[model samples]
Target: MKPVSRRTLDWIYSVLLLAVVLLSWGYVIYASTVAAQRQLRKEYPDKIFG
Candidate 1:
């Protein structure tokens, strides 16, 4: 089998790095949304889906 080229390796690394960064941002957004929902529920016990 032929060895992998440097350029191909760089591209793969770049794609992986981008995926990690995107996932991190998504997690942060999800956590913030959950926290906000919890806070709303505490503040408005009678309201539904606010």
Candidate 2:
């Protein structure tokens, strides 16, 4: 068995961090779009479909 090097660990950590950040941003954008749609529907139900 061999221990992992510092550079490899840092690379892994950075990749994981970037993935988390990207996922978070994706979810935020999706949620905002859904909220906006809901608001528009609530405010103008007829106008939305037409």
On lDDT, the candidate that comes out on top is 1
lDDT of 1 at 27: 100
Give the per-residue lDDT of model 1 (tens digit) for 4-47: 99999999999999999999999999999999999999999899
Clashing pairs in 2: none
The clash count of every prediction, one per candidate, is: 0, 0
lDDT of 2 by residue, 5-47 (tens): 9999999999999999999999999999989888889999888
For residue 29, what is the lDDT in candidate 1? 100
Scored by CA lDDT, what does every candidate get? Answer: 0.95, 0.92
The segments of candidate 2 whose C-alpha lies over 4 angstroms from its true place after superposition are none
lDDT for model 1, please: 0.95
